[model samples]
Target: MALDFTTTQWITIGAGAIVSWLLLKWITSPSPKKFTVKVPEAADPKWTGKVLENPSIRDPSNPSTIVCYDPSTGYLIDTVPNPTVEEVKELYNRTAAAQVKWAKTTFEQRRTVLRSLLAFVLENQETICRVDCRDTGKTMIDASLGEIITTCAKLRWTIDNGESVLADDYRAPGLMMMYKHSKVVYQPLGVVSALVSWNYPFHNAIGPVISALMSGNGIIVKCSEYVAWSSKYYEQIIKTCLSVNGFDPDLVQFVPGFADVGEAVVQSGVNHVTFIGSPAVGKLVQRNASDYLVPCVLELGGKDCAILLKDSDLVQAIPVLMRGVFQNCGQNCIGIERIIVAAEIYEKVVEEMNTRIGKLRQGSILAEGEGVDCGAMTMGNQFEKLEALVQDAVSHGARLLRGGKRYHHPKHPSGQYFEPTLLADVTPEMDIANIEAFAPIMVIMKHQGPEDAVRIANLCPFGLGSSVFSADKKLAEKMCMQLKTGMANVNDFAVNYLCQGLPFGGVGISGYGRFSGKEGLRGLCVPKAFTTDRIPGVKTPIPPILDYPVQSAKKGWSFVSALNNLVYNPEVPAKVGACVDLAKANI
Candidate 1:
């Protein structure tokens, strides 16, 4: 029934098909431009230590609100509402209600919201970084690297591959069930919650939200009270994106308060919870989530280790070592806390670390300028603990090569600053070597060989991330395999986080379950197995031999055994025998 066409008509049809194909490609392709953030060279001096007369005041006039301030200089930021348990419950209710409608939306609609958010983040990169710096006291460069780049990468990844990850995954039916069709459908959980950390405020808050929305679940983020100032801005950005995209703004909520509020979030009848913070608090979250029988994905702290083999390239490894220890003032959960160096290159590594660490200026980067390499600590009280750890190590025969105490900033005397520290000859016995030091202190331990390096690296109770540096690729990979960490890099440090496709989480005290990659995106959903008939008018049926009123139990067993052998037996003679046995059993 084919119709013959003229040459001109055929050419016209081909031209139309080409145009449609081109249009579809253009529509589907992601934006080609790479998002960039401009790191400021200097900050205004006035902003450095501009504190209110009563900077520590917690807004006594208004009990409903909690005061927020810059931990670096005690500068007062705006106060935000502190939600009560009842308020937290209300938030969950609202989000859950919105999710009911949102779950019905098409993938195109979810992508539209993400595209809008991507545009907003790019246009307001400076504002976003500034808000994070103001609240967390991190440097502009740190904010650009940790906040801007990671958030953009997450948004882009989710937008590009989220639909495919959440698509119905078909499974092959075995020979015994050839007439059956099976698939796993990823359906959204009504509501999900994330109790994120305060280190990278922007990324921590936005990351779970991205997964929640992409998978069609509403999320309530319980942010760290330490970064409540910036959480408000992030909340606005997320809600505005949702509102503009015609989705209910209540679909995304941010709760900022004390521990009680966080407890409420976990016990608020949410379908799932994603918690990122210290190990101590993670236990509490697990306990509370247990009451409701709610499942949780906990991404807790890590005492990550970096091993430097004798054959490692010092030229390339030195910079990575410095950044791994000092980035975000070493507040990173997966930051390299201990450096295990081969005995051959132990002295060289220590000397290089000492020289570079001595030159690093510590101050309030937001108020100062490019002169400062390391910024202030968010938790000033941790200074006492850090000093105690360092003193303990030094007393145990560990040598303090450089700064190991708190740095008193001349310009901003009240600012919270820890000196960039270098501790050499650290042993596995010292507390500093085993404990998680979320500060700008580099601890180096000498290892006799590859086995010793791995032994020292795995000594810590926490096993989140690890790195092995060696010129010999095979040796490095072998060492990485032996390291007891969730994620290990052969020649780099913490670069696994940049590749959004890989699952990001850890084993042991680092907590359980993942919150990134396909595992994470689908973690927010319920994977339900679906089955139906592959052919029309064909279906599964109960055989009389296996029915409720079986006349003879031995005959029924023989019938089932013969059927199994006929379908699965490898030998042709065995299969033929089984078929004959099956015929006799049926008769």
Candidate 2:
């Protein structure tokens, strides 16, 4: 429209055009600051709900009490009281006091209560799903199943298997008339501080929460500030469930805020602390626990891997890998951010992956129509970190095969929307490929064989979960054993099996303790072994028909059945002794 223009004016106009183009590209790209998804109504057929309309907060004067939040919509989650060391100490004392009653409750009683709660959770699965959806901004379907159903499954598994898991015990018969009666018993660790992360706050945190509760411990939770509302919803439902199921209402309580609040609560000397979070926080909690001689279960971060063997069906592998990468929009702790593809068909697999990656419909998550396969970054930091990783790869000469930009779903530009991204030609040296990209970005790399694949997969500071895809029985079995992770999948996504009544934990930077399963009970309990004699005044010692039973004088020859001998287990017995001593100190 201009007949003449100055150099400076043209420059300004050009710069503006470039800036506008960049902004538009960013706004229209697959990455958005925060994306919101429609909270689902159910984890199963019985679940249902709508977004919460308006929720109320707790009365400041009585902040120790919690206000029930709607399960349909996570609203007004928790209100923190000004907690002090004395209050914390008193809380622990009360927890200890409560444990006696709860522990005395039969395993059937605990199981009965948990079974009722499980049934209720399943019945209200939809409401729980929607609550999670509201809290995490994940797709309702994923949140419902991942958070709600998974939590319910874990609770049910623990209830069903808690007693038997603790029943198996043994003892070694010492040489001579001496014997060591060895038995492993699971007792509640008394007061446990449950620290939940923001990512999967609704469901994942509850696994340990229920586990601790079923094992007869009082759990005080420091919920994620980012999704505090969900914490409130949990307190509401769980408290009601406990009351109805005949458990103490004080068993579970919610504390809200940032690190300062968490520190204050942690420093209060709770009996045991169970934390699910990043490595930094995990270390801090561990340090605090060490100072107080309080036991803690630290479940930290993960840079999980997905291995594709030569015989893996490319068709099945593609979808499995897709879900592994994109489920929870890549925010899952077990999300397989790095894929190790076999070199025999590396290009073929990458090509197929690219084709399927294209079909992941990126759109407005909350729009009325059937939306995209994914949603957005649950946290703003995650969004920026993902964006930086893509830029870093580009700067380092790695090719961006699928996504190199951010975008809002065309219909809902205002919502957080990120196109699922794929990067190829990305070497293991690239930080994004090895570091924690806790977002919706996935980097694909090739591996020559199982040994090489495992090497690359294990080349990380974090070892949590891993999945191996192959039809070969021998290779799958080998990988399952050799894979360096707390949990390994032979032919499925690592997070798919929530019903297995096994502990879900990690190694290295991933976590230090196990949750769910049988180990879950042991993690939150003390193993107290005692040797007792029926008669109070009678002193019994190892006695034998031989001249002397080792070096004992007290007569118990009636029960002597073996000849005198020596000690064994070598240094293992000493190490075990040290561990037992440490365990006793922790309790």
Candidate 3:
């Protein structure tokens, strides 16, 4: 017998069923206790941490506390007192004093301090990894490779190579000015305000600090408020390294605060600034720096792309291509956001990528276990952004090849995890393709030819990085050259960025200035050209030959012409005669 029911009654039943399923899903998931850091009491005499806690260092009355969370489990981790404006100013004042002393130190002394830091990082690598993992929600492997290893490598590189790079360069005086000896001297540009981003906190902060200190400049690192735990840990270790090396720990100050403190730092008369964050905030930094005439090095956002040509080696490109998007859960500045492929090979590549992304293991955020290719998103707020982008793309006729929804596991109910996602039929007109989605999402766009692929890649405003993979090395190189980016790779992704000897920065809307190379070490310095009269047994005339009132010295032009002819004249007799004439005319 068929029974008739009202449409509203069926709708109510459907909604109730959906709620029941969600409840069941939540109940079946594993639960874990929230992680928390023990805040030292005011009267605790055993608090031996390096962070300042003076009597006057209390937070403002009714100040908003900066509560931190473990992104892996969406659990409360710890809370810290938000620094007041006055406190940030005090920190800067202290760093200024420290800079004066640090600048006076010898090159060997600075190198020693840097070497000590390298040693500390190596010895405590595992501990550092755990702290960073807890703070960032990235896998242990990422923390080890990206933070521990990279930070130590940068420190060692700076120590071993910094002196020679920053050495006083002597230039030969021109024949026209024979007595003048010129020298290019690189000097420290006082204190540097390093505004660090939350992602890859350890390496980014340590990288600039090593360069700044090795170049004999003081640095005040303002760590992200969201990840203050990692900053505290780094600060403690850095202070110990500094103290043991007979240097003032304040030379590298760590001030943990939010955007307000960062703003104060910029306007507080720092000699130079280096900021790493989104382009919007970077623009603010530039505007602030302009007020004080302070130059800045900004590593802003990136919508980096990769072009998979028809002749590309799919076997070789699969792993790197996957890692390029999934690594750090796609929170990296240089991570690939879009892929342009030749239409002939596009379908095959899309299927292969879909299968691989589908097979990727989503597990606990801890680095202890194996088989987890991805971890939770470091920032919980990013989940909403990722969802919005996916929705917008779907609405605009884009198709999700795989993994567009939030990921859930029975063992981690509250974890902020997004499955590795792949989207196809993406176009330049879609918002998802244009925006920098700092999540584990990869968009594939089809192109008719190599030129079309290049056109698609260059359509974005960001020019941070681009990569191309082709069986023909020369073809790949040629294509990569046409890609507008500060760093580009042929048949590989992020290889240039990983090479510490090369400059890692961006172009156009991605921001400017360089870091991680000789240019970076020198960017924190003030170059002064020193010229001196060094010619022996030469006495200057009372009136200089090139003086303004040199109408009486009309013969000087003849001497200049003779000197020019003496150097360039091919004939031996002419050269000899010209030299003789130059000396005679000058006399």
Instruction: Score each candidate by Cα lDDT.
Output: 0.87, 0.68, 0.79
Q: How many times do residue backbones clash in model 1?
A: 1
| Tens digits of lDDT, candidate 1, 531-568 | 98899999788888889988889989999999989999
lDDT per residue as tens, model 2, 191-281? 7888878777777556666777777777777876666666666777666666776667666777656676677668765777888888988
RMSD for each model, in Å, please? 6.1, 19.5, 18.0
Best by lDDT: 1
User: What is the TM-score of each predicted model, taking all chains together?
Assistant: 0.92, 0.76, 0.83
Q: What's the distance in Å from true for residue 274, model 3? A: 0.6
- At residue 434, give the lDDT of candidate 1: 74
**Descending-lDDT candidate ranking:** 1, 3, 2
Question: Model 3 Cα displacement at 470 (Å)?
Answer: 1.5
